[model samples]
Target: MAAKPNTVNPAQKKKQRAFEGVCKSLIPFARAAAVIASVALLLFLTPFVGIYNKDIPGMEITVGGFSAALCALSGQFTNVGAAFGNMDIFNHFAPAHCKVLAACAAAAALCLLAALVLCVVLAIGKAPGLHSAAAVLQALAFAALIVSFAFALAMSGTRLLPEYCSGNPACSVRSLAILPALAACAGCAVNFAAALRYRKAKKNI
Candidate 1:
């Protein structure tokens, strides 16, 4: 006689279904968690940035440009020193005239973190609209980062601020600019990864 065939009983089937449901629920969240972890690592490595320059104005063009942008966006740069939305908006004062540059850098870090998380969630969700938007935002962020790197280099090389180099150790504005540039690069990288993941997920699906 032949052996009895194995069967998936009703209870076993129900348990399997439940397990699958849990996995489906966790997939998006797990991707989100990974994005957050990456952002956190960047934050931990970022130095505690001070006012763009405590010493001189001309040597702080990068900081000044950041301040002017913040000031224009928020209307008062110094009020928001070292924090978000605090810079004066009119660009009346060059980046060196205000303390808002540091604030803008901090804000950029937060925005990039948010962007990373959003991109990861959108990718895992496999939403076409969200993924497209993330890709666009990532591109813009990359562009901004590139421009920032250029400005930083320009400021570091200019001889406008002799005081910056007069210190015992003689620090350059590049010293300050380098940190934000690195942070911006990290943001661009993560956003790009998220976009790729979104594309891959779409293809797989």
Candidate 2:
């Protein structure tokens, strides 16, 4: 006797169609997740930075974002004569506000992590309904990160706390610091492009 060909039942066929639809709907979310991860990691590469003198090369006293946030939030560094966010240099009371920016960076990290998880679930699991929330979280993270960078660069007289730097004719910025700032700028540009593309794709969905 000839063997009969195996066939999928109607129920199985319907389940497969549903699965395929779910996966297709998640393509945009996967793209956003990749962009979000790249942006978040790039921002984290920036030092939670400060320095005593800008004249010398490789002399900035930089710390990690999480460590700086913790120290600032808990007032632990105050006892060590490091009064953060309040400093005087070059006859100017420059409020660096590093404490606040550190906190923002920490909060952004949390948002990024949450968004990444949501994106993964929506892309891999059957949770397309969470797409909007995930996108919103990623946007928030990106905004907060940008705000932190802007805070560092705005009206500081330099790349970071030029007022705090004191030396024999200290310049506004150091040569070494410029490299990281430029790299961060490129990362921001890439992230912005990805966001625009995502928005356009979202409208089609």
Candidate 3:
């Protein structure tokens, strides 16, 4: 007797195929979002915000008094002071604290970079395990960014020496420094959401 042909369930097959298409589409989106997030994180590390001289509109006095993105261990502070004249006077005292902040910023950037690489790998391979791993990395990067920004805010209020502004009341911390961090956080959130979406799509398959 001839063997019976294997049967295929049309509805189930169609559902499976749809799930696959969804997963494929989501992978690229996730990858793109991760890349954007990583770039935003790196940009946030730059010294866009800091104390500025009110007397000199364009001059930044005590640059990066809030975050370690520019003045951390890199000695950008010397440059900032040279450019602004009196800015370095206040910033000199905070080198140790700035170094710590710089470390945090560096860690966050590394985490974001790792997550970005993993995201690209996931996009290329479409591995189920990688989906979860990428999501975890995104989460880790976001957490690190948050921690760095938090410390920045704390230092902005507490660590700023009053002596820096005693003779020059014009010196004030700029709020714009936190904006990049906020933007980076937003990017990380988007990337994290995309990763979760991709993971869910995979699970449905």
Candidate 4:
């Protein structure tokens, strides 16, 4: 009698192939979003003065950094607010907005640093034998950023962009700041879309 022939399971093979595809598509979108978000947040570090001063640009920075930070910490939100008091740059603005911006700046900085970590994790995750939850968390993190950024922008509209203050409410609000804020609105939209897609994919998984 001939030895029993070995058999390969076709259904199992198909499932494996599908899982591989899901894994491949998973992080690319998340990484791309993370990179763009990182760059956008880091861009806020540009000297915010003169014609470009607006909470929107700053908002983008804050949001981007925040999303990145979540990815960095493996989806944990850490408090680093008091750390802003140690920075000299925060000393250069109106007392009220300065404190607000300083706190925002510190948080954004921490988040951007986190993005860098996410970048590495994402890149290395493609190798064989690496397990990562970041691809899933990236969407959630960015989603939180979108919601928070919108809330912050709305809140600041009634408050004031740093450039609008002359140490009193009597000062005129600058028209120039409106453009950056508008630009930030666009960024927020993009962030929201990314978050939606991320959430949808996560649900499917």
Most TM-score-accurate candidate: 3
TM-score of each: 0.44, 0.56, 0.66, 0.43
Order the candidates by lDDT, highest first — what do you get?
3, 2, 1, 4
Candidate 4 lowest-lDDT run of ten: 83-92
Q: By TM-score, how accurate is candidate 2?
A: 0.56
lDDT score, residue 120, model 4?
47
Best by lDDT: 3
Q: Which stretches in model 4 have alpha-carbon errors above 4 Å?
A: 1-9, 47-93, 127-205
Whose TM-score is higher: candidate 1's or candidate 4's?
A: 1
lDDT by residue for model 3 over 155-198, one digit each (tens)?
Answer: 44544636555545666555333544554455556556665766
lDDT (Cα, tens digit) per residue for candidate 4, span 125-192: 45311212333333333444344334333434443434435334333222122232333334334434
TM-score-based ranking? 3, 2, 1, 4
Task: Tell me how far the alpha carbon of residue 11 in candidate 2 is from the true structure, in angstroms, after superposition.
Answer: 16
Clashing pairs in 4: none
Which of candidates 2 and 4 is the stronger one according to TM-score?
A: 2
